[model samples]
Target: MKAIKSFSIGLIFFVVSSCGSLNPINPLSLLMGNSWALSSLMGKSLDLSQFADGVPSLNFLEGGKLAGFTGCNNLSGSFALEGSSIRLDPGAVTRKACPGTGEQDFLGALSKVGNLKIGKDKLTFLNGEEELMSFIPKED
Candidate 1:
């Protein structure tokens, strides 16, 4: 009885410790487990640090869904990726209007993204051959 109890506790511990691994592998799995923060937009190098509390990021989930912070409002949408080809459909996003925030510009760039390139520590989204946005992996 004591041995069984100890084994159960060990199993529970293992499960809890491996929770991070529960994320399934998908086409975007290579980009998963990382939050890519917006670094640049429309060829302009944005200084997001000056925004004080505004930090925008994109995270691709296991399914075809995506969740992101639009620098002002929260956003979630469906995405399709094949090889380097990608498309983002911003289906449902929060409509809270925060003046002076570049929410529209951010969403516009995201909608124009037709391809993705994952670098050593960065992620780049492109519209055709032109780079639309560049991102750096957020620290865990």
Candidate 2:
């Protein structure tokens, strides 16, 4: 029957179209709602004892909000993402009379971050092609 044949064709078209509508995994999903702890700075491993706090860490929140600890003062900022590129704007930092210049170094490096890459177990921030900092997922 013509009606049966037309129905079959329509069903096939619907199935094909539904498959096409499925979107690929979004990279933002990997970055949002995740926390990363500072692991290495400028290719050098950090000595946690140097920090008064346990370790510097970052938490990426919804709506581009950023919160972290700089090993001395609390860090707050806003971040924007475009594809794999990122821009972090450092905001208010508590005056805690940090002993060394490590906090300053961390914030300074943060300001220069131009992009980011998320790997299997690492998140890396880079300025162009040079890696500025790297982080590991904060254990919950």
Candidate 3:
């Protein structure tokens, strides 16, 4: 009886310790697994799957960095997260001109995001009470 109790306690400890900080249950893991493409911008709907080129996408990299394509430019920036709040700083972006690309507007909306809401297959960036950008997980 004594040995069984010890083994049970040891098993529980091992299970709990294995789930430490890097567990898949962490929200960041769920957010990072998919690169998200813009579904809408400032209430204007867009379907990125239909676009032949210049499809904007967003990725949340590890180590508090955000990197993605801005339809025409590659952008990388630091992101601040506090509890449920988030802010994606407008970082460096290549300035090569791509006429008719919505790079500026896309980056603009990202900079304004004050929080992020993750749904089943969508990511919504919000500024205060307004939805600034909407995205759906992009296919691998």
lDDT of 2 by residue, 38-138 (tens): 99887789877667777898888888888899998997888999988999886888888877767877898999999998865789999999989999989
Give the lDDT of residue 113 in candidate 3.
87
After superposing candidate 1 on the true structure, give the runs of residues whose Cα lies further than 4 Å from its correct spot.
1-27, 47-53
Cα deviation of 47, candidate 2, in Å: 2.3
Better of 2 and 3 by lDDT: 2
Looking at model 2, residue 89 earns an lDDT score of 81
* lDDT at residue 38 of model 3 (Cα atoms): 87
Candidate 2 runs further than 4 Å off: 1-25
Candidate-wise lDDT, in order:
0.81, 0.85, 0.78
Top candidate on lDDT is: 2
Q: For each candidate, what TM-score against the reference?
A: 0.73, 0.79, 0.73
For 21-138, candidate 3 gives per-residue lDDT tens digits of 5533444765778898888998788645433356788888888888888777788888877755888875888777766536667777887889877766878889988999888998
Model 2 reaches what TM-score against the true structure? 0.79
Clashes of each: 0, 0, 0
Q: Ranking by lDDT, best first?
A: 2, 1, 3
* Candidate 1 lDDT tens digits, 15-127: 99999779554437667768888898888888564333387788888788888887777878878889889998877888776665477778888888999888658889998
